[model samples]
Target: MGTFDAEGVYHPRPVVADDLDEATLEDAVVRSIVDFDDGDIVEGTVVKIDRDEVLLDIGFKSEGVIPARELSIRNDVDPYEVVSLGDRIEALVLQKEDKEGRLVLSKKRAQYERAWGTIEKIKEANGVVKGPVIEVVKGGLIVDIGLRGFLPASLVELRRVRELQPYVGRVIEAKIIELDRNRNNVVLSRRAWLEETQREQRGDFLANLKPGERRRGVVSSVVNFGAFVDLGGMDGLIHVSELSWKHVDHPSSVVQVGDEVEVEVLDVDLEKERISLSLKNTQVDPWQEFANTHHVGELVYGRITKLVPFGAFVQVGDGIEGLVHISEMAVHHVDLPEQVVQPGEELWVKIIDIDLQRRRISLSIKQAAEGGDVSAEYRDAFGEHAYDEQGNYIGYDYSTAEFTPETEAQAAWADYQPEVEGTTTADEGQSAEPSDD
Candidate 1:
């Protein structure tokens, strides 16, 4: 066959039988490629694969060579992963024929066209897709999402990840965040995928959850106000006050991050998606039990837990509270509570009052202040003491062993007029007070 060149020169390649026969052959050739429009995807067999390009036979007279640059949508993917000899492939027709009489084709572009359709439908339906992490670029990662999809770093994981290299070569599932076929832009997010999935699941989980139900969870975070625990698929807030029976400034004082814990669901607000759980609610309340075991006017031993300006807080029973007033330190007045009471000191106190409704107990150290039955010993050692044998001492303890009055009683022998002692004897006693009776 002979064809005219662009320079108006004629070249003879082969000779045919007649003009009609030549026309028939040319018609057949044109008809074979008539449906092969530009951008249309067509299947072919790999004729050869080389470092520079791959040759494919798509029932065309001339084998088409796809350039290495066109083998993959990603810049870093090795061409060897794309094709092998004698393997079937689909490609987009770049042109019928180029200057070299060779068919131009692109496998990546064909896949790209199909990807646009699939990605558009998936994105519209809010569906998920899986792919491998091709590379981690600035602010995001490139995933081979049947196409090069941009996944923001913020959305790469359910939570933010510091290192991104570990994600490479790993397959991941993600939701399509954005998609544009005209501009060939696609954005993906793993976080959104997980959140959407969990949102659906959490609704059902809450539907079955009820108050007073016990469940196990992991401590997600320990904050000052409370600890947030993740109960399998949901999270519950454990207030600091309900964390334990002991006093705590923060939830971390008792529970730690990632600790497995059992909790009772104290409250649940489905509308707000809130669950109030308690770690201490499972235990028996000490104050409730103490009501039956003890009563007012009974002597109970306790330790000083804390002190305030007015009184000292004493721990009566397991979580019970009792106040010892400053005046109760002894029968005498006390200027400060700390003067006689120290924290953690053990003392025997008489229960003066118990407000069960308010969870409070009033104790008096003064009622038991006499050290119970020490009267006889104090009466014999008294040095001008005015105390009755019932353990009442008017003066404070100044001397080492006992309390002595500021004034001494008159000598007993002196009351007998001291035998006149020279001048005042019987004369001073008889006529001194004649007028008054």
Candidate 2:
């Protein structure tokens, strides 16, 4: 062997057989280093992290370089956030060697390849994918499910959620509705998952519900005919007619959306998935209460509310009315009811009849006024002309007498007479008609 000094002088040295073999072995080891092609996935340890790139040691001749953009699927990420020194991770080979002779690698690409296989298997098994909401975009949201999954706004909930901002950072489970490998697109629907879950719950709710049972629920919506109430598992309808004992013009008059109310189950149709509820049945009936305390021939004060050809209706109490037939309005041959009574007129009446089963009451104003004095002024003015118990004239008459003070009174009475066909004087049975003058 020969050696060179620092002064560039050649010197002779002793040669060993082991030294000659070591030189030959080093050359063979260098030639035997493994070669890797583009797109190969390799495991490595993060050796360095910088602002723009990361260095990974994958047992290669040189450390692999992963640019900042290739570190994660997220955009504008800092290398420090995606990886740390000495952390084991998998990377995809982007290039065997770049122009600078450094191996180019991508951590995000390796994750994408692994995620595609996992998602396919989940879909085949009809499994659910859970992830956190990452971004809110136009018409939808982006969920991080190993990769970015698009969840449309309409399919986010059972009903469309108006505010998508609140969903950000929330973990949710969804079903895969669409998948395209070539386009790298995935569509998810949370509504489908919810509907399926609710259907099972509804079946159990319907089985346990029975007629005449009371329940508490929230009013979900009001329609012209009824209001729909949410009973936790399903929605039941409260018809307008069943809202109150009194007549209701519309369902909104009794209940509005989000009102909490107690209701009774009136009926249920399992085949059709329908439930009928009654809000009034849970309260007291005013008509039944009035009937329990009132009876026939009892005097009550009321106001005339409506008039028809048959009779007049008077409201004696709240939601309680009694009809007075025209024949009962007065003790005379009355041609019309309005001649004696008018709408909005308040008066006293006696209940003549009651039909509790039919919910009817008959009243009479004339009968209630019976046995009262005719007129106090008329009695004082005609004291001289007395009448018997039958109301017949019994006093003496002076048709052709002299003009005395008493004689003048008798002459004035001779000219007056009653208009009845047979009676020449007012009869006790005859009812007095109010004078027009």
Identify the runs in model 2 with alpha carbons over 4 angstroms from their true place. Answer: 1-35, 77-79, 301-315, 320-437
Kindly list the per-residue Cα lDDT of model 2 for residues 1-437, writing each as its tens digit. Answer: 23446653435456455544435877755764556789999988787788999988777787899999998877788999889766889999999899999999999999999988999998888889999998898999999888889999999998778999999989999999898989999999999988887888888899899999999999998999999999887999999989998878988888999999999999988887899999999988777876776666555567899988877999877778989999888767677778877899777566788887887889987754432222222234344445557443443333437323343323333223232344422335543332221
TM-score of 1: 0.69
lDDT of each: 0.73, 0.77
How many clashes show up per model?
A: 2, 0
| C-alpha lDDT of candidate 2 relative to the true structure | 0.77
Off by over 4 Å in 1: 1-40, 94-102, 156-158, 162-171, 181-183, 284-305, 315-321, 342-346, 353-357, 370-437
Give lDDT tens digits, candidate 1, residues 1-437: 23445653435447455545446776866766535777788888776677878887787777787888888887855667888666789999998778887889998998888888888888888899899998989988899977999998899766677789888888999998888777888889999988888887988999899999999999987888999999998889999889886678767778998999999998888888899999988777677677776766665566789999888988867677799888776655677888777898776566788787887889876654322222232245444343435444332332346532332221211112222323332222231111110
